[model samples]
Target: MGAEEVLTVISNVGIWRLLKAVGRSRQRLGLDAQRRRLVRSIVAHEERRRVDSEAHP
Candidate 1:
């Protein structure tokens, strides 16, 4: 999923719950690396955006 959708999902699920799910997923078989990477990248992107906005504002 894209960053916007991923952000939506994170908002809906709650970040703590999503992080828990990711941790649990790693313990299970058939882990989806691509999805995890996407989430990570999106999270990093959001973090950067937030920092940038705050810095400029």
Candidate 2:
């Protein structure tokens, strides 16, 4: 695979669960705020990429 396929596998495995694990671990380590911002940024960037790809294709 491709990047998209890899991302698809990640999503299929449950993105929320993965994010929650990251968030929880970060919170435990005292990085709650930064973790939340990171997750939001990642989500926003992914959304934009998806939209752009769909629009162009």
Candidate lDDT values, in order: 0.82, 0.86
In candidate 2 the C-alpha lDDT for residue 44 amounts to 100
Candidate 1, residue 40: CA error in Å?
0.2
User: How many times do residue backbones clash in model 1?
Assistant: 0
TM-score of 1: 0.46
Per-residue lDDT over 1-57 for candidate 2, one digit per residue giving the tens place of the 0 to 100 score: 999999999897797777778788775666767788899999999999999999999
The prediction achieving the highest TM-score against the true structure is 2
Model 1 scores worst on lDDT over the 10 consecutive residues at: 25-34
lDDT of 2 at 48: 100
Q: Estimate the lDDT of model 2.
A: 0.86
Which runs in model 1 stand beyond 4 Å of their true positions?
Answer: 1-31
Please give, for residues 23-51, the per-residue lDDT of candidate 1 as tens digits: 87664433577678889999999999999
Candidate 2 backbone clash number: 0
Please provide TM-scores, in order, for all candidate models, with all chains considered together: 0.46, 0.48
Residue pairs with colliding backbones in model 1 are: none
